[model samples]
Target: MAQLSDDCFAFGGPLMSIDDAVGIITAKVSAVTETETLPLIAADGRILAGDIAAPLPLPPFTNSAVDGYAVRASDLPAEGEATFVVTGRVPAGSAAATPVPAAHAVRIFTGAPMPGGADTVFMQEDVRVDEDGRVVLPAGLKPGANVRPAGEDMANGVVALRAGQRMRPQHVAVAAAFGLTSLAVRRRIRVAVFSTGDELASPGASRAPAQLYDSNRFMLMAMLKRLGCGVSDLGIFSDERAPLAASLREVASQHDLLLTTGGVSTGEEDHVKAAVESVGSLVLWRMAIKPGRPVAMGIISGTPFIGLPGNPVASFVTFVHVVRPTVLALAGALPEALTPKPVRAAFSYKKKAGRREYVRVSLRSAADGSFEAVKFPREGAGLLSSLIETDGLAELGEDITKVEPGQSVGFLSYAELI
Candidate 1:
């Protein structure tokens, strides 16, 4: 864990640029060491702790790609078709007792191993079968046609999956193909999430004079869950310092990461910043990005603490941009794991020069067969409906003073992050 300076909350200097803020967080956070072996059924979405090598070839032997007659290419009749005696039938999971002989064909089904000395197969549609079940080779049948060679899919001792790769359903199939019952993966990081503010009220609670239902916690939890983290909800914390401090101390010892929304800004009712400063260290606050400028990062009792903005849209953006990547890295994921490549902007909007901005935009296809991005009507950070209606966030650089209607800007697909 990294400690924050006493002046970490002082947000006066030219609003920290988005790039600089990412670099700071990347440099400060340390990766966790916990790991475990999980069964194949439970390994989906988990990060691989080691490379998965193939113990043997994927197919393990030459087999038929389709249900057809297997024959030697040289044994075919010169002009039309060559007739051969059907030696035997080989189905999937069965072995051929004897090697195939010249001028002989074998009846094989899909996925069945190709008998030795047979190098090609003719589909049943291409050949005619007599009442006695004997088959005739078709004309123009090429050598090695429709025959799957040994080790074509995967060679023996080949590395199918590299270390640090996140496991998906396809990866699981690869493991099963290699006869692996389980895989070594990093354990899910335990995260404790909460919101702090007197004005915040849990949903279904009686509305206070100036209180609003706290939605940031739900958003945070969803984002954490998508990152494969085990989340512990701490609920909402009042403005009092004692309860907040107790909750922080208790969760710090039990969880690998602690996250909270609200109380990170400069408002007097913001007690999360103060509590973190008193108990732990506040590393950085107030990023240069719009809609999510009031972000906080710190460490408490060797556990990482992320204080997201109180606004719903701001909280969602900051979590995807910052907290998600941090959590992934702490869970032993590679540095390049969370950062997605920028898509070419479909539409453009206006912005000032010094600050970075992320605009919610819906993607549309144009008459010219190209994608055109359209911005949401509302730009306020508190407008949650804008995110729901939009496709993804369009990232504007700090140097971008004005954007033309069709100019290309950096865009991030929402599906890429969530």
Candidate 2:
């Protein structure tokens, strides 16, 4: 856990833009310093603690890139084919006993080390074998045509993977190629997640007349787990100042971050914001965004906290676009992984100026061979099914008010986010 300066609340005057909010979080948040060693098989999704350099040059020796006959380019005649004696054979795992001499060729396979004095490889298709155990070589073949030099893939003593990288499968493969069985990675982030509202009840339990099942808690917990965080579910708590403050203080000491839903707005029953302020500090950021504008970020003791809106769709969207990056930052992962791609708009949309908006859209292939973002028929933060029915969100910028069909727009797909 890390603490921010007391002046974090200084930028508290207006609804902050999405970019400004992200900048603030990136500037103020510090990554967890603790690290642990894990086997390469278990290192996926973990943040690297340090750079990994190649132990030796990749391939370690010059080899043939294809199954061919290793030969000297000079053996081929200037304008006609030349016959060469087949001296020896070399497969992928074995090396030639002696250097190839003039007018002689070595039978070679893919990945076989290139024999000395043989600078080119003629693929089996380009060479003809005779009954007398001789190879007829073609003319005009360039030297080093099918040979892979040592260190071609990676150089020795060079950084193969850098610090703060999230170890993907390909990254792990690189480590394995370098003969590393284990890797040093940042420890899994510990998270405490809860829902705040008396009107919320557990999903399996019978609910009272006006009570709704608590979906945000499970959602937050699953999302945290997907990010490789060690999450503790605090469950649902009533909107009371005393207990809420006490719980906040208790969990602050145990987890690296606190996540809650439903008590960030300025409504009368929204006590989570006040409770956080009483226990430590809270900056209510009325974000200049649609669906989930009321977000609270702060610190208690030293643990960071993020409060999200109660609506299921809003919680999902905010967590994907905002809290996901915050988690990556805290875990020491690269930030570029969160960038969304662009897609053409399939339907027209008109939005108000000064507020960014996200609309659920399913992609449809147009006659022009480009994918178009088709907006879902219904729009509401509380409608959870909207997320299930759509492929992704069509992100509309704050400066843009109207988007016509076929216009390019930034899109964030659930596949990428999840």
Candidate 3:
């Protein structure tokens, strides 16, 4: 589990920037020390524990990159074309039976090893069979034009994969190509998720007249799964101060993180703030971000805790920025920057100058085939439909006060968040 001083996150302010919050989390939070070995196929999405050195050179041998005739560059006719007796055929996975004599060519398929004494290839489509059944070669063809040299992809004993990388399918392909059967990766971070509020009810449970079904907890769990976390679904607990405080302290030892949605703000009925204070230290961060301004981060028994807002949109937006980084840090994964793609904005909007805002938007192609961002028609943090109907967020930076159509703005796609 992560270790931290009670006052590590002591830096607070009336309004903090997202960069500041992330800086503290990255600087203070220690990655868990445990690690596990897994099969190559199961390594995807896990953090690499150490650098992976190539066992052997990629391709391992010199081979043909295309179906063609292999010949020595010196034997080619200087002006037009020349023909040579068809010496032998080399198929993929097979070696040459014998070296080709001068003035002879070999029929070689893609991935087949070049016959000894051959240093050039003429693509089959670019050459022809002569009347004598000999292979005709084109002039002006470069030697080694269609050959994959040994160690062309990577050399043996070189570091091919680095530590702290989140493994992906492409990375798996690299390992497989290097003949790796297993990999070492950091253990998945364990998380405990729950919610608190008298106005909230479980999805299947009977609801009181003033209660609505809880959505934040379920949404948060889904997000956590995407980050490769092992989550224990601690169902909605009582909002009463004593019970909530007791629950927070009891679960901190078993999990790397304790995550809650809602009940962190200073409301007359809000008990989470006081509840966390009783058992752990809390920092109520009012970030300079729209939709997710009020976020609560704390420490309990050395485990990190994060409390998101009650609003579904706010919860979703905050998860990508706050919870995602914290989870990566805990799992020993390197920081993955969320780089927004620039797209033309089709909607006009205005906002305060000093705060950063993410406008939910859908992208469409413009007249010139470029993508333009279209904002959701309605605006409210509580509207769950806004999240579903939109494709991603349009990032308006702190210096951006007003936006007009045709202006280029940074866009963060939903696919990039995880």
lDDT of each: 0.79, 0.87, 0.91
Clashing pairs in model 1, backbone N/Cα/C closer than 3 A: 346-373
Off by over 4 Å in 3: none
Deviation in angstroms for 360 in model 3? 0.6
How well is each residue in 136-185 modelled by candidate 2, as lDDT tens digits? 88787887899999999999999999998988899999999999999999
TM-score-best of 2 and 3: 3
| TM-score of every candidate | 0.88, 0.94, 0.98
> Candidate order by lDDT, highest to lowest?
3, 2, 1
**What's the number of clashes in each of the models?**
1, 0, 0
lDDT of 3 by residue, 129-214 (tens): 97889987778898788989889999999999999999999999999998889999999999999988888899999999999999
Question: Candidate 1: misplaced stretches above 4 Å?
Answer: 1-14, 77-85, 130-134, 139-142, 336-348, 409-411
- Please provide, for model 1 over 1-418, each residue's C-alpha lDDT reduced to its tens digit, 9 standing for 90 to 100: 3333444333456578766776666665656666899999899888889887789997888889888889988888768766678889898889788878888889898889889888898887788877776787778988999888778999998899877677889999999988899999988888999887778789888879998888889888988888788999988888887778877977888888899877877677778888887788775566888888888887777677888887888888888878877777677776554343444455557788888788888888777776767889766889989978998878777889877776776667888876
Model 3's TM-score against the true structure: 0.98
Report RMSD (Å) for each prediction in the order shown.
Answer: 3.2, 1.8, 1.1
